[model samples]
Structure formats: structure tokens, C-alpha cells
Target: MNHKVCVQLVVAAWITGVPAQIGVTYQIFCQNFCGSNKLNHIFCDSSTLLEIACGDTYQKEISLLVNTFFFVVIPFLLILISYFRIIATILKLPSTSGKSKAFFTCSSHLMVVCLFYGSVTIVYVRSKSSHSAKSNKVFALLYTIVSPVLNPMIYIA
Candidate 1:
């Protein structure tokens, strides 16, 4: 029970923190990007924000690298390490009567973790190799907007 509560709190912190970071970054970027021109998408797009923030050549490259690292790479590594530790602990457990039940619970959690992390990694990990503005926008939409919506669906399932 204590472990569950702690885990829930940690997850809550992460969920809250990521978006807050994004929001702060967005505001900082938007101050530069949000004038005169109307954004095509309803939600404030990160790429659009970046395009606006990157008015100068130096600023553009720096903003791109920073956004990619923070929004994509860091989260991917964190999720990977988390899941690895989870699975390792599960695997090392001794067999018992409740083992099946424990496995079932872990399976559901593993599924959600994989789905969320996989989508995020698929999108953001690609950014490290290829530097396409369009791809970044598409992945940003996936990781930021679409994945959050799907996360709840995974939990519900």
C-alpha cells in the first residue's frame, strides 16, 4: 500500500512536471512566436513555437537541440530505465500462490508503459537522426497531444 501510494505520487509529479515544463518553454517561445501570424493548429504547436523563437540562425539551432533533448530524449531514457527496473524486479521474484495475480497486474502496467514509451520514443528518438521540421512537428503532436489522450485509454483498458 505504501509502495503504491509512493508510485502514484511519483507518477503524478512526472505528469504534472512534464507539461509544466512544456508550458513554461511554450510561453517563453510563444512570446517570440505568437504575434501577427495565426497558428494553423488549435493547440499551440511546438514546432510553430520553435519557428517563431528561432528568428535568428543561432537561436534556431540552439532551440531545436534544446527542445529535442528535453521533450524527447530525456523522457525516453527515463521511461526505458524505469521499465527495465520494473521488469527486472518482477522477473527476480520467487514463485508463490499470488504470483499469477501479481503477474497479471504487472502485465497491464507493462503494456501501458510500453505503449506510452514506445510512441514517445518512436517519434522523438527519430529526431536525433533526422532534423526535419515537418517530422518534428508531427512527432511533437504525437508525443505531446495524441499520446496523453491515449494514455488514459490504456489505463481504462
Candidate 2:
């Protein structure tokens, strides 16, 4: 079970990170040259590095697409499948105590999953929705700092 979970997480991180990294790298590089737009890191915009990555509308669209797929759809599908198998396994157990214990473990996992994904989704969505640099910084900071801090606490709880 531990191995499977580790594989799932590693795969999830790979899937989520790689494509977006390639796409963003290509977009930032190509667009700046291919369009001959001045690549100025001006103070008029970008309070955080995330804002710089998402400086343009096209970049923002790409980010939204990646986040929607990786953070929302893929995780939802994986979690659903895992939970289904867990339910089946627990049902096959002979004793009430075993099933209860399984469910308790699953519930904690579910809570942590919710906390991690929920904050990320909110950060991505909020970043996309708002035009303010300050709010974007706040969202970025929350995701970068608070989510990591909370994840372990959630697991411990």
C-alpha cells in the first residue's frame, strides 16, 4: 500500500509538473522572441515570481489549462479509483473493527487530500480570476507556505 501510494504521488507530480514546465518554458522563450515583445520585468506588474510566470494572457491560459487538468481532473479520478478499491477491500474484511479502522485511515487521507488540493485549486482559480497583483501574491504565498505547513498537520490529525 505504501509503495502504491508513493508511486501514485510520484506519477502525479511528474504528470502535473513536466508538461507545464515545458509549455511555460516554450511560451516564455518563444513568445518573447517570435513576437519581438519587449521582455521587460517592469514594476508595473508582478508582485511574485508566479505573477512573472503568468505575466501575459496566453501564459495565464496555459497555466489555467494545466491546473485544471493536473490539480483537478487527474487527482479527482485517482482518488475516486483508490477510494473504490479501498471500499472493496474493507468490505471483504471479516470484522467490524477492521472495517472501521480502514475507514478511519481513509478518512484522514481524504481530509489531507482535500486540504492540499483545495488550497491549490483555490490559488490557481483565484489567480486566474483576479487582476490584482497583491491578491495574486497572497494566493501564491498561501500555496507556497501555508499549504505545505498544513499538510503534515492534517496528516497528523
Candidate 3:
């Protein structure tokens, strides 16, 4: 298939999975959180919600880790594999300019992926504590703001 067709198929698959992801996330996180309504983090993301949870969180943490492994870690691994293949292909090109050009085509994409996923893993995947809340916000900001802004700058450049 052509690149466009392949992209469309990926998009279709992603669209179908989004609801399932959202559903599982909502089931895991949407709960009667007992604490000060005032949250410590800038956003009311899972990390913040988890900080305020009242009961024993062993079960919830396990579920979140499993869900994260499936949704985040798996996809990140796939992306890394794809980049490895791309890098191999680029390395095989004989012309110096050809290799650089090929690498440049996807370099920005890889950077953006690393920026977002690396920050996300730090913010959500790690076991959180009150002390870590401050650091989580920094990573969350990178995930939400800095990573996305790079997309336009890098891709549109």
C-alpha cells in the first residue's frame, strides 16, 4: 500500500481503540476521591487524583500499571522498533546527502515522540508520592505543552 493508505489505516485503528482506552481509563480513575478538593498539581490528571485517593491503592495502582503497559509502553516500543528499521534503511543509503536527508525527514518526529513519551512515563508511570508531585508537574508540563509545540516547529520547518 502507499504511504497515504497506510496512514489512513493506522488512523482508523487508532480511532477505534480510543474509546476502549478512554473507557478503561475512566473505569480505573473515576472514583470517589476523598481529600481536600484543592489539588496540588496544576491539572487534575491521574497523578493528582491518585494523590488524594482515600483507600488502599494497591489494586488501583496495579490496574493503572497494566493499563499503562498496554497503552503507553507497548506503543512506545513499537515506535522505537519502527525508528530502528528506518535508521537501518538510512544507513544503507550510499550517498552522504541521501542519508542525512532521509534521517532529517523523521528526526523531528522521533524527537517529538521521545519528548512526549519520556515525560509521560515519568509523570504517570512512576509510583508517585507527595514529594514527587512537584517533579510530576514539571514533566506534565513538558508532556502537555513543550512536546506539542515542537511538532509545529519541527514538522513545519
The model with the greatest lDDT is 3
**Candidate of highest TM-score:** 3
Q: Write the per-residue lDDT of candidate 2 for residues 1-157, one digit (tens) a residue.
A: 5999999989988986898677655554543223333323323222223344433556545665575676576876789788889899899999999899888878777765665566556545544455464544555555566667766775575
Q: Which sections of candidate 2 miss by over 4 Å?
A: 1-16, 26-56, 126-157
Model 1, range 1-157, lDDT digits (tens) per residue? 5999999989987996688677556656555544557654445644455445535534544555566577557776887687778767767778864567566666766665565566555543443346555555565566566767766665665
Q: Whose TM-score is higher: candidate 1's or candidate 2's?
A: 2
- Please list the residue runs of candidate 1 whose C-alpha ends up more than 4 Å from where it truly belongs after superposition: 1-36, 40-42, 52-54, 94-141
- Model 3 TM-score is 0.82
Name the 10 consecutive residues with the lowest summed lDDT in model 1. Answer: 120-129
Q: Which residue pairs of candidate 1 clash?
A: none
Clashes of 2: 0
TM-scores, one per candidate:
0.52, 0.57, 0.82
Residue 79, model 3, lDDT: 98
Clashes of 3: 0
Residues 81-143, candidate 3, lDDT per residue (tens digit)?
Answer: 999999998999999999987788789889899989888877767765433767877888998
Q: How many clashes (backbone N, Cα, C below 3 Å) per candidate?
A: 0, 0, 0
Alpha-carbon runs more than 4 Å astray in model 3: 1-16, 22-30, 129-131
